[model samples]
Target: MSQQDPSAAPHDDRPRGDPWHAFGYVVSGVAFYGFLGWLLDRWLGTDYIVAIGIIFGAGLGIYLTFSRFNRALPPDSSHDQHEQN
Candidate 1:
């Protein structure tokens, strides 16, 4: 067996997970919030303005969620290392 170098940087072995999970969660969350807002507005009979606000809030939540996953890198970056050189 070949000896391993302790000084070398450790390699990542697991498959790189997608960063889009958060985005999906955000989208679902927004849809849920929007529905709630619409229900509340309809029940209170204050017009649809509150519903619109709820939609905007949902959009914001989606954006933030997607942003969180925007920086995700692949599990194996050997290709990246080669490209960098």
Candidate 2:
């Protein structure tokens, strides 16, 4: 095998990812929370819980999307440094 080049650009092996994951997270969160809210509204006889649930779900979805797709990363250093080499 040929020896690897030393001066070549670093290989970004990380997956570039897709927008669908975030969409799914947000959509799924809204759906799940909305369903829960409907149930709660039925049981508690409160009409506002559905709206609150939707808002909460949106926020939760964004948080989860960031926490997940944003990548936990190799370490805190990864935040500051993009180039591994």
Candidate 3:
């Protein structure tokens, strides 16, 4: 039986950081852009701009969240090529 390394990090099922962080990003994006669109619609007397803004905001939020969180993750070492050699 091999002993566990004391310096190894503990395994966790959940990713680090506030669970609401991603949700907040998406909600804030939608609210902000939707509000902007609503104001634009009022100013320009248009009907569909608010809907467009909401869709755009949601897409932007998802992209932003993906870029922010996905890039920060460390590459998996379990498949490290050098270790197999």
Candidate 4:
């Protein structure tokens, strides 16, 4: 058996670090909200709710995408600062 290094971080094998993930999130958001709006419209006899829901879903998706992808990360102390001895 090989020994593992305790200081090494574990590798992530998932493929979520891509732009497609954001696109999927946006599309799914829009579809889900649009479906909900369609149901509400059918129940309440409104014709414009689906459009409004689609727009709202798009806005929400954009906000979520930006929040997840455009976040400002803190400076890395290991590389940005030198240790003072």
TM-score of each model, paired residue for residue: 0.43, 0.67, 0.65, 0.71
Question: Residue 57 in model 2: shift from native, Å?
Answer: 0.9
lDDT of 1 by residue, 6-55 (tens): 85766655434455665565677667777777787888887675567667
| All candidates: CA RMSD (Å) | 6.4, 5.6, 4.4, 5.1
- State the lDDT of candidate 2 residue by residue for 1-85, as single tens digits: 8887875645454445678878888898899898899899999998989888888898899897887766644545553476655
Q: How do the residues 12-50 of candidate 4 rate in per-residue lDDT, one tens digit apiece?
A: 333445788788878988998999999999999999999
Candidate 3 residue-wise lDDT, 1-85, digit = tens: 9898975754544455554877888888899899999999999999888998898898888887777666654565654765787
Could you give me the TM-score of model 3 versus the true structure? 0.65
* Candidate 4 off by > 4 Å: 1-17, 83-85
Quantify all predictions' global Cα lDDT against the true fold. Answer: 0.67, 0.79, 0.79, 0.78
* Model 1 stretches astray by more than 4 angstroms: 1-7, 10-20, 50-54, 70-85
Best by TM-score: 4
